[model samples]
Target: MGNQVNLEEEAVGRRGREVQRDGEKRGLEGPKVLREECPSSRDLLNSLRQVEKMLAVHEASYQQGLRSLRKKISALHNSTMAIFRIGKNASCPKPEPPGHGRRLGRVFGIGHEVHFLCKPTYELIGPRTRVCLESLKWSGQQPMCRRVNGTSNSLASFSPAAPSSSSSSTSSFPVSAALSASSSTPASSSASSPFTLSSSSPTSSSPSSSVRPSHCTHFLGSTRCTCDVGFTISGRDNNICTDIDECLLFPLGQPGRLCVHQCVNTPGSFHCFCPAGYDLARDGRSCTDIDECENRMHNCTVDQVCVNTYGSFQCVTVECPQMKNATYIKTSSMRCERNPCMLGDKACTQAPNSISFHFLSVVSNMSAPRVLFRVSAARVLGDTLRFGLAGGRGRGHFSVQRSGRQTGTLLLVTPIKGPATLEAEVEMSELERNALLGRYLTKVTLFVSLHEF
Candidate 1:
């Protein structure tokens, strides 16, 4: 009976190993979705559990097997990452416990910060640290992250790698020390294989694996967020910048996949970054316009157009012609001739100095409510004018007669006028014109005129 039990346990271990190997092959197939959880991931997690159980049950032959299996599990774990932003961060989630696999820092930036291991489980997407700067308020829209000032590479919290107070400091490296610690046991020798700590400088490695550089922060790409060449955020915008996905809004494929470059957005500006394209100037704040034309990196065809915006450049097949007719949203209009004594030279201008708004009085349909105009102008409170008229029925819109003056009377002197005369150029909308017929002419003219008085 003991032998049979051993055999059954051994069989399960062998099967688990096979399933895990299959998982290794499948996991590396492609890029996983950003900030999401999938069933396959859960399945992989379950396999790790089974492997852990198998090692525990079939204690003898599986001891050595467990070591090898653990290595593979770690490798698989480090290949991906999961990004789950907190709408309102509740309790920080524990990374898949122990054998669950390596995931990156779930809570990034500052604000109710809880320390969880940041492991590079998958490719980093969006910003690495959603840092809320202490210099900013929560309701703030543009949050800031510290970008590396230069090319310094140091582990963020390693005991030996304390940060320097100098303006230039090494940034956070995108490696998983804590995640590495998960698979490596307290007694295991292979622990250090996954994590390399240099005795001289316990900080992180170079260019790629670095932390938030001192005095600079703006990350939209991954856990290993390196800011664009220029632009640092100490507490500038308070780290409330919303992600402006360039791919979603603009066509970025031109000029050798321009969108492939970094698309970091600043408070009032943004830039497209390339790995080795150009470096920012010493100013460290503004993106010194890269003259792509001079860089020999431009992918423009022989006859194409190249237009330079603030930070980046674009080559276009069809250039936009200058605006021929731009529509300005209308805010105010005025009636110029209220009194018959007003127009020196009556003109049809957009904003006439002397003007008035007309109010609707009699309508063709009693069922349809009359439309009234709410007037607002600096001249609305001035002396009112009166103009009396003889003609009672024109059965059409009447024109307001303006008498000659050096300037026009701009006040609404209402006592004048009956069946008001109006200039006939303005027409109502199609719906309104149709509704105006057979209606009693409410004969009132809204006018704004400029008089010396």
Candidate 2:
């Protein structure tokens, strides 16, 4: 009975062991079964890795293709640039030279050069030479020929033809004798030269005898020639004589000018003229200012006063304002005095104590904000004083500003057209602690002339 019981226990232990083994096998198989139901993790990971590798390859290929395209574009740009360069190197358009000028060098290509020249009387204004560049353009600006500003000093010298025996005495005529006659002659007369042969000479009988004359001296089969006082020989041809333009040669502001204001050039001489409001003095080159006011040359009316200025004259007038209960007295030519006001007369008391007239000449359209006139009190005993523009036709163009304790300035605030009159009433008020003392009115008349100087 004991042996049987021990065998039974061993059997029971073996059965329990077998049951535990079966449970462990089921646990392992459970995961395998679930993995089959879904997708395998290892297969999924391998597929994702392959797809990533394919995408990397595609990206690399795309980048390589983009690089290839960029290279082709660069090559095309280079080819186009080369073609443009070739076209530009072929030729350049011909340039036109200025009037009275000529250009040298016929070829117009890259790195080529050209030169310009002007006539004898003209002057070259711009670059003398220019070069064609690779960019198909000239290197410098096109040259121009401009007429010279002053007269030329070049002389024309020629040998006089052999004089006949009858006229040999007059061949060496003295220039001094002709100078006196030329001075007395008018400038508008034709040019007369002492070197010219008279019609009575034997050589004058020929129809082709040259009438042009020059100062000449025969010495040992060689002749020396010269030009007269007011003439010079041409640079190109020594046989030709040209008049000297004294006006252009000696312009204003330079020494040796013919006139103080204006110089008019003629065939062989020049004339001096003075500007308006001036008289030509005894000395032909100088000028004297004309007193239009004294001479009564102005067109001023009886009410206007004639004022003289440099190179011009002006007419200006100022009248006292008409007001009720006020009486004005003419103190002087340019001043007026008011009678003392009555104690009960408010209108007379409020009016200006004195009114004065002033005339001034100004250039047309002068710079604005310029101080035109100044008003000042010789003595200041008031507590306060003020200055202002009262009323006039020119009030809009003017302003009054205080310059000092007892001085005020009338300033031109705006520019105005001239050949017209500008009238302004400037009033000065004296106050003792804000109480009105007296007001003086000044009637300023400005004569704006059309001339600048």
Candidate 3:
């Protein structure tokens, strides 16, 4: 019975071994026949699986290295194509000289210690003299050598690089195609065609007609164009621009329609232009002068009249613009009236029953064609009606005195500066009288009529 029992135990052991083998093969069974099998067998099987995963990880890393190498090769190939491949009809090219073959007396010029080996200047043993490129020593592969026909300063030719492929001649882009890009532009163009680069200057054979002015000189601050403002180039050539004057060539500043108007054109600068019938004032602007004689300058010609008009000198037998209350004063005094008080708005102060005046302290504007001054309370002191307002308290009186010259007629009332009666008096020189008298007066007219005078 014991033998029978031993046989049964042996049969069970063999069956367990077979089940474990089949499990391992199916990847489901292993040293453990089932999930509930011995734990030791499960642990051993897991350890073996870990070893397989580590091996796979190492192999995948190696494959990645191969992919990187492939990328590097691709980059190098593209670089080689860019640098070495020449396109047909290349725009600009570097010159390349032909190569000469190795001579019988050549040298292996490569490697470092050449001079120590070969003498500085060694001639070969041949009948035609030649310098040994080989250093003094008997070592090294190739040595530089040359025939004795040339002098020492003659350039030594180095090994030439490989020859590049040549291109055919008929590869130029069409000229019409080059010109098509900027048809609207009337200016010279260099856009379409391949323009040659010269270290010095452009060659004569090139189309200079299509080039811009090489150098432009400035006068004052403006550039001088060959053509004037209204004209343009008349021919295909660059230097053919023309000038045109629509106005008759009237001398500038003279009475005219166009040529040489009131403005002066220097080499570069230009003056403001004024039209005829308008007098050009000092600021070169148009202003009207009243015809005081017509309305009257003095308001009376034979008596005391002179008139002013815009740009023109005219005689008006009519009423004056300021006649109603125009206080007669010396024509020379007009400038003083512009800045009536040297102190401007601060010239006076207001008081309840009356107005007070501030002495201008140190006054200015005294140097004028006609100096005008008003004594604050001169007339208030009952000085001979020297100044009288519409409502006469005789509070003020103004003085118009000559400090400089006046070109035309002048009439003014004497100021109370002295005991001179402050009465309206006509002051005229012999020449002034004749000029004022229309019968003997010459009508001097304005050159430019930007202003009426």
Candidate 4:
């Protein structure tokens, strides 16, 4: 029995080797072979069961790992796609074509701005700066710069006239004498008649043609009556004429007004007149505002602003903060608040030089709340200052006006939810001969806390 078992075991080993070789040729992992054979048939059956159990456990672990790897790869691919989408959406639009005016800036991307400049003799008709919006479009239409019309009295030189009434005659010359006169007479003598003549000679000397009425004239051998000024020929035979009212024909139209503010029709012509605060334009038919401010004709004080109205102007006083020992005064260039600090006095160091603002609650629209503040310094030469927000939480919300060199107004806007804090910073620098003298810094903090009562 022992010999028989050994022979069987050997046979089994040989068969296992053949199977492993076949699996290797096919690029597959082959099953492991047992080094020792079972002593009896019952032992062999038990060993086979254990080996099957181990193989099942390892297969389950491999499937779980494969599923985990697939999930990670899918997540990475989705992240990459999301990044590409954002890069594509952030692209800017193309630049517009050049117009009558010159553009100051070249960058035309989102949130960028461009300024327009007209020539010396031209005037701009729209916003000075156009900004690119988030919608991939410009905020407003491009402006146009057109030459100013200085010679307002030269309208007659460009005005259109009737095709038949270019030249005027004295109306005293007889049509028959013009026809009977020989070629020796000057062409100018017969051409004086308002009616255009095709030929100087009469076609026929019949009595009916020569006996025309006094009011009628002969042209092209045909008798036609002449119309008075402001009248035109209207009858079918072109003999009878009717009165014409020039005021009824586009008297109020732009560039072709026959009257300024009011029109009066006369028997042979029309007259134009203007209303109060307006004077007749150079064309003598339109009304233009009489600029009291431009002509130095205003009665406003030096500290008042001459704001031009429709037909007149208003004098408005400059607004100043209500503070102790501070008075508003008007200089040659601008209106400013005068304090001891403005005189370069050392007493300014003891006075309160900082201002504080508090906001306990905000409106419902917190997405973009606009807050304004003003900062003023002594009018000193070569002294400049810059204002900005320093905190990372609300840095995007602050914007300062760049126009005022010494005194300026700062604006803050931001979108917030719940409670937030803002920190503002102001930097001051002094310079002489374009060389820096000293630098100073100031800070202010604002706490925004809202309660849902």
Candidate 5:
């Protein structure tokens, strides 16, 4: 019976295991089935519509928040820049402690003014007050304190006696400190001192109180100071300051003047300039064309011509004849032969017996008769040929000269009558071995006509 119970228990356990296996399989298949069963298109569309409505409801608020955030960031950035004076350090000048003078407001800040005062018996020179300019500089130099009598030097002797009510009232704490500092320096009285002023006062000192030359009328204790950047100290002691000309000191490609052409130095400033053929551009540093031809500044005459070049113009004289119907042919270095005949007509002809030539008529209003024609020939027969004027009866009306064995010139004088024709004849005797072999004759005809001139 026990065996039977044990077998029954084993059977029951096996059946429970099979049931558990089936449940595990169903659990794994559940997710796969759900994944395969996609939602309907209509349901997806409905969900998307709801999302759109929600996004539309929040879009305006989100954009408004973004704009507000940007505004806040920009304001913060600007405030931070103002506080730090970013990008302004090099452009702004630092404050300089005045000697024997009183300064008000922030000296280092732009648009701030500084006023000055002198001791009772001293007078002030230069502007009484100066203001800081946008260029980061004081408007004027520091004023000097001179004695009332105008005979006291810049470093006048002062007694260490108790100050008078008037002297104490006029001097401020800063001014007094500056004056004291300026007076204590040994350089103030030296000849090398730039602030050394002439003194006409007689040498006189009281025995009860010791007196020393003082550059300051009030007490301000400080040592020598240097000038700001772009400035140099002048005068003997290097107390007088002046602006340095960067254009003159440094050339292009250096750390100074940026001018491309010429550089001009002005008071406390400098500028660029261009050459004669160029003009100053709107930028004031660059140069452009002056356009001499376009501006009618060229010296070309009517017969001459003008051509534009880079930044300048060129004057060119008409080298060849510019007549409408004539074609120019170069005949010599100094003259050009012009042909005015039609395409088929012969302008010049040469032959063994007769040579004929044609030239365009020239009309002039001048009184003097000009040379109408010129001809020259080279001898091929050595001394066997003789050339002379022949067919014209008015030979005396023209001047003739034999330049060489085969060369001659003909000049036409003032004509007494109308048109005339002239002819030249050449007679040649052929020779061989210095003996005559044959004779030949050549003739050339020239026609000359004069107008009313």
Candidate 6:
């Protein structure tokens, strides 16, 4: 009985070895061959199990043979399981490519990677590359290619908000470590092989575009999407938020606008901007006129007076005129009063008795035929005054017209582009029936600014 059991055990062991070798060879033939041959290998193992059960009836007599047969069966079962595992891990499911982007590497075998690239003017929103894992899953999240918003580049005035805590630090994936720990097969070992999808021909498939951002927070049994400080919720979905164009919402010319001069729209907020001669106020939503004269920001010389305007400043120089028989006294920085002279002095009566200086600042290329200055007699009792433009560098651009019996007006006929200094003198003669009694001259200085307020 012992010899019979030993013979049966040797035959079974020999058959098991042959089946193991065939299974090993078939497993090398790829997953398809292993799948087709796996059933036969299982049937052979069942036959060996039956033989071991039949010998178990004479357990004490054929203990060695039974033990040997069981060992062979165990070895064969382990080999089959290993082969099955290899076949199962042969490949992973192919992942979908991102929209407006192209993917490389068609082979979906374990440890294999696929690279993603965005089209021109589009941005990649997720991982650039993904690797296949032993669990038959792709590493990291699926990537996407989104359209690049023109607001990012065109709106250079936009100030980006600080990064959130979750996005402040980047975290790296442990794909390589995971790959190393997974069981290695013939396909997995050569995972570095060149198996790339065509990147030259980009896919033209269109995907659903997101209109708003997806940033949500959960609290008190409720979930809400929150945008940045300057952003607000958009649409009825309540899952996303979009940027608020404050500049468009509150325009410059509108009554309740944010800025006094100009409003610049950012991604999430808006910025107030003042014109050339103004500054942004402390409130950040309004603009304040810059006091160039008070701040000493004017370029006036030491001999010139700095005068502030609506949005600019002007520098003017006033000096008492020197004439024969005309002694002038300084009444103010811009006024010159004639000293009392003898009534018989003809030169003093002929020349101007009082001369004053006036300064004005205007923007470049102002409208034509604007009344710039008015000259009126302090007191008049049926007295006539003749007003005319005296000889000066800026006489050609101005004209003096008699407005009333004792009043005259200075008209700017031509607009001047600046930064330039225009000097014009207005001579007012006190007359009684065409006879000149006394004369008064006024020097007018116009400071044309380079910028239009």
lDDT of each: 0.32, 0.65, 0.29, 0.48, 0.47, 0.64
Clashing residue pairs for model 6: 105-197
Residue 126, model 5, lDDT: 65
- lDDT tens per residue, model 2, 298-399: 899988878886567777665565778998877776877789888889888888889888777776678898998999987776899899999888788999
State TM-scores per candidate.
0.15, 0.45, 0.17, 0.28, 0.26, 0.41
The lDDT of model 2 is 0.65
- Which residue runs does candidate 6 get wrong by more than 4 Å? 1-264, 275-277, 281-287, 292-304, 310-315, 339-348, 381-383
Best by lDDT: 2
Q: Per-residue lDDT of 94-211 in model 4, one digit per residue for the tens?
A: 5453355566445666667665545544445455457777666777776775554534222111221222322322222211111111111101122233343221222223212211
**Superposed Cα RMSD, model 4:** 28.7
Q: Put the candidates in TM-score order, highest first.
A: 2, 6, 4, 5, 3, 1
Model 6: how far is 61 from its true place, Å?
99
Reference-based TM-score, model 4: 0.28
Q: Which ten residues in a row have the lowest lDDT in candidate 6?
A: 179-188
**What root-mean-square deviation over C-alphas does model 3 reach?**
27.7
Ranking by lDDT: 2, 6, 4, 5, 1, 3
TM-score of 5: 0.26
In model 3, the runs with Cα more than 4 Å from the true position are 1-231, 244-277, 281-307, 311-453
What is the C-alpha RMSD, rounded to one decimal, of candidate 6? 34.7
Which candidate model has the greater lDDT, 2 or 5? 2
Tell me the spans in candidate 4 whose CA falls farther than 4 Å from its real position.
1-215, 219-221, 236-239, 251-255, 291-310, 324-334, 341-453
RMSD of candidate 5 to the truth, in angstroms, is 24.2
Candidate 6, residues 1-453, lDDT tens digits: the string is 999999999999999999999999878888876678667767999999999988877786688788899999999999888757787358778888788776655678887877665565455556656888877788999887665553443221122222112311112222211110100000011112122111111111212111234333322333344332334555444434345566676676667766667776654446667777777777665556677999999999988889887577767677887877888988998899898878788777777878888888787788999999999888753367678998667788899998887788999999898777888899988777777777888888888876554
lDDT of 5 at 264: 62
**Cα-based RMSD of the predictions, in order?**
33.4, 22.5, 27.7, 28.7, 24.2, 34.7
Q: Per-residue CA lDDT of candidate 1, range 42-127, in tens?
A: 78899999999887888966777999999998777664322223234434323231222223345533353211221222121123
